[model samples]
Target: MTTVRGTIRSTNTIPADGHGDDQSTARARAVDGLELTGYDVVQTNTLSSTAAGNITVRAVARSTEIQPHEASGPNYGAARAAYLQTIPDGWISLGITVNA
Candidate 1:
């Protein structure tokens, strides 16, 4: 419950649209973006959807750390919004997961 160093792989992936050259690169960006959005990303992976063209990104990440600073102020919301801004066109949010 409250003592969770236990973050799940809720990493949201940006679409491949001009974000990176390949899946590996995109995954790297996912890690960076997650961190920028206020997550201490521990592990990362990618999943491709069964859906058709241009919708091929699913970033999986687990946040192993949650700082005390995250308990107040704007938290990840404002930072997350800024991070989302960096995502190029055609890449909608796959979404984010709070510590579970």
Candidate 2:
């Protein structure tokens, strides 16, 4: 079994109406970065605040793959690359964890 569970905290400057979609897009990119395409979403949460015309958003996404075969381990290198490639501007990863 392989499991990837962690919180991705990020600060962004976005408008209120665009916050939701942007957050969702960020979460999806992070998930794709982890290479958990077929995994289940354990939990997802986001919190946002606005100040000085900038909105800071914190997104946490948890995912898991149960009883995966040998080929199912997380590709950390690729994941990192994907994260770097997909993450939106001004968004950063606070932390992450992976268990297999």
Candidate 3:
């Protein structure tokens, strides 16, 4: 069994060029497995002022444990591959700093 944990920090420039608060959103994914899709949302913070606004989000995600019996598939990598595809497309990962 393996455990995965991470955090996310994001910010955006608002009211750019007098452009009235551009709508924006951010997303973060856990690991590269189907079971890793679900995460516990730790905290989300928003800082706003006359100059700029910022947002910070934190969360923790875990991967599914593989059973010994289930590891004998014809395609050894199929389990992992299936889990990878289960992840949503364009999902942004914010745990780079931790892993890097």
Candidate 4:
């Protein structure tokens, strides 16, 4: 199986009326180095910090990762399309890195 890593954080902003964004304030929380072994999440190391006192969080849209196949098909395009449909609405990638 192949593994990948990404960081996830909330984009929600918590407005504080009485609180402040001073040195003691916690603005944002992120899970860095979150490893994904296929569809299974293996690691979730947390990293917390703030930027510009705005609870800034950086992220990308959903991503797709195609698993490795052990079987061969005559028409890869047709088979791939049909197989891709089985995946629910989410990330859908086309290829992978094979290590020999």
Q: Give me candidate 4's TM-score against the actual structure.
A: 0.28
Q: Please list the C-alpha lDDT of all candidates, in the order they appear.
A: 0.39, 0.41, 0.28, 0.31
Q: List residue ranges in candidate 3 displaced over 4 A.
A: 1-41, 50-72, 87-100
**Which of candidates 2 and 3 is the stronger one according to lDDT?**
2
- Global CA lDDT of candidate 3, please? 0.28
lDDT for 35 (candidate 2) = 34
In candidate 2, stretches whose alpha carbon ends up further than 4 angstroms from where it belongs are 1-5, 13-74
- Measured with C-alpha atoms, the lDDT of residue 25 in candidate 3 is 32
* C-alpha lDDT of candidate 4 relative to the true structure: 0.31
- Model 2 pairs whose backbones collide: none
Residues 1-100 of candidate 4 have per-residue lDDT tens digits of 2222222222222221112244333222222222223333222222233564533333222223443332222455544444445444543434432222
Off by over 4 Å in 1: 1-19, 36-38, 49-100
Best by lDDT: 2
Residue range 1-100, candidate 3, lDDT tens digits: 2222233222211111111132133223211111333333333223332345332222333322221111112342554343344434433234311110
After TM-score superposition, the amount by which residue 57's alpha carbon in candidate 1 deviates from its true location, in angstroms, is: 5.4
- Candidate 2 lDDT score relative to the true structure: 0.41
Q: Model 1, clash count?
A: 1
Model 4 collision count = 0
Decoy 1 TM-score against native: 0.27
